[model samples]
Target: VSLSLALKGFGAWAPTIGWCAHQTQTCILLWAVSRLRPKLCWDKHRIKEMLSYGLGVSASGWVWYLKTLINPLIVGRFAGETAVGQIALAIRMLEVLSFAKAATYRISIAALAQLQSDGKRLKQAISEGMELQLLALGPILVLASWIGPIVFPLMFGEEWIPAMSIFPLLGVTYLTNAAFNLHCSTLYVLRRNWEVTAFHAAYVILFGILAFFLVPHSGIAGYAWAEVLSIVTYVVAHLSIHRLIGSPNYQIAAIWWAGFTIAMFSYQLGWWVVGGLGLAFLLPEARNRLTTYLKHFRALKTG
Candidate 1:
């Protein structure tokens, strides 16, 4: 609200100040809310433990900022803003598909945290979470595939038509990223930050090297593929590590993923409907776990 009003008032002459005004108002509101709720308390020992885990989480953020920044930095430096704009456009379009992924990442900790700290529960949560994410993300991607080409040019005009080439690969990247989110969250729940941190660092380094070669060769298309490839690497790394640590049947989600893709490309709603029913028989336990996860989320939300 403040942002919109400030942009209206000062945007014509000094647009940068608009965000500054908005941020000031936002901070004041946040401060007021914190005061009303009053969450923090002084406990030195507990604070010390919290700070250590918080720093691990904070370290992952720095790794992410660097990981996502490298390719665009390379693209902007070599290929110019037009390429940057196309990359941004493709990613922005893809972000819509991550809605369920983002929400699950944010909210499922409470449920997963409650599941008795046993192998069966942990494995159930991890594997079923993957299936639920596949179900959530796949239909939307298929739906978007039907409309995106037609909608892209109309929505943003013909200048962005070239970006459509990069769209599918970016969709794949976001699919892989959704899995990455769950794995990262699972790792956080399990207090396995050492390996997670190491993997993030390695991913960024490997992604930078791939981008160095890719962006120069195939322009934005190559860079998009690099992102996809690196994301696949992250997923594989997590799957392997997850298995080594505990969850043995992590690859089970691949069947659903393949089915979803095939049904999507086949463009068969009946097949999807049948597939939805089939999941109940094939993975009834998983369906139940997902139901429980959602009910837990709803309880948390309404509370």
Candidate 2:
């Protein structure tokens, strides 16, 4: 079967654990919001739009995963199951990072969609979201950057030693990736939907082509590098979209990227202290806004 056909089968054959977890997260958030605001309208068109957004984004994820799964299939058939199993387990571990980044993006989507105005509110929502994402992912990147290799052998077995060289790079790459994904919410909220699709295409096409040529020669390391390069391409495409949409304070982009790097590189001894400081800075603002949201939700429910 063709790769496309095979992927269709694979997607149907067994839902990925990652996909399942993501769907569960999305459903839980939607359910919580609905319960909090019982009167929110949910017509067919609205349901369709929500499903379209979720399914469209879900397909992008599945494309990368299907291709990742294919590599092990090819390896097991051509080389040996031991080689394939090592790569499979390693890839599974790498997927944990991808899912973490994706979950943050998903939250940003719901958060942005709840805000007012397609232009001003969307950008502000995304900016605030970028702050929260950096705060959440910063220490994670720090710990992973330092200990990715040490943890791998214990988690996936010593046979996966080849993955050691790739894991730290993969972790750092997630920092960039999480930043890029924050814009996905912006793209959708502003109705710049095609750009979102285009970037997802860029990620898959660039990664697939690079992996196609490089993996056979360089092994899982090649695959790892391909993924990192693809993430960079994804980030660039989002920046281009910002320009195309009339760039709104490129400072927003700078703040997110620079802040993430600073947070990641700061002294580990004081990182948690810094995180607490950030909460102190943001809490009053966040609390007031959340209180307003709850008031609206309560009014909707009571009505």
Candidate 3:
């Protein structure tokens, strides 16, 4: 709320001001709510122990942040500012659509860390996380894709229509991200930070290479396709997690993901949106899963 209001008032300076205000507010709230305080003393052994773990997490984070730079540095060089803008618009839309993934990611790390020692419980947690994420994200994605063509021009201006071409493809990318995000969190909770780091490194490298080769020829759509294709590499994370704590129940999640992807693409392709929606929402298994989740939510609320 502060950020939005700041944007309205401060315009370009809003981010810096809003971020400072937000952080200050968070600090104050934490200070008020928590009993913890900073100590003036430190232990060398504990410091070293923390650095050993913290360094790996920080390394993975830095590598992940490199992804944000690839498009501007690579795509801008190859495709020009217009193409970069289109891809940016698509990515921004995707980020908004991926709110559920972002929220679950933070929670999963803590929750899965507790279950890391038990393979059965860990697997169940991961499966439930994926299901709940998809259930929350799927309909919103479908609705956005359905209305985007009509709304994008009106909202962001007609100049950004090219972004619509690749929005669904990037939607697929985020959908996959939402589904498998827990696997990444699982690796982190298990203290396999380097493994996650390796995955991030590989993804950045693959995306860069794909953009370098494809963007010059295919433009922004090429960039979007690169995103979609690079997500296939998440198979590496899946394999890593399987070796650690077995695999989650991907069967149902896969059905919904596929249907959502097709539905998003249907706007670009043809009338396949009907088939996609049917597959996602109408399947007996899909319906049953939805009902199960709803009941679970209601039970929790009522209980």
Q: Is 1 or 3 the stronger prediction by TM-score? A: 3
What would the per-residue lDDT of candidate 3 be over residues 1-303, giving only the tens digit for each residue?
A: 557867579776777777788899999999888978877988999999899999998999999889888679878998899888888888888888788779889988988878878999999988878888887887888788889999889998988999887888888878888888888898988899999998888888898889788888998877888877899688888888888888789978888887777887765578867676686777898789889999999999999
- Per-residue lDDT for 14-83 in model 1, tens only? 5466667778988899989878765668999999999988888878768867966864689888788899
Q: What TM-score does each of the candidates earn?
A: 0.76, 0.61, 0.91
lDDT of each: 0.70, 0.60, 0.85
10 residues in a row with least lDDT, candidate 1:
262-271
Candidate 2's residue-wise lDDT over 145-256, tens digit each? 4565677678767777775655544555666666656576666665566566667677777877777666677776666666767765666555854674444444444444
Instruction: Show model 3 residue runs off by greater than 4 Å.
Output: 1-14
Between 1 and 2, whose lDDT is larger? Answer: 1
Q: What is the Å distance of residue 30 in model 1 from its true position?
A: 7.7
TM-score of 3: 0.91
- Model 2 alpha-carbon drift over 4 Å, by segment: 1-70, 73-84, 94-100, 116-118, 243-245, 248-303
Q: Relative to the unseen true structure, what is the C-alpha lDDT of residue 77 in candidate 3, on a scale of 0 to 100? A: 91
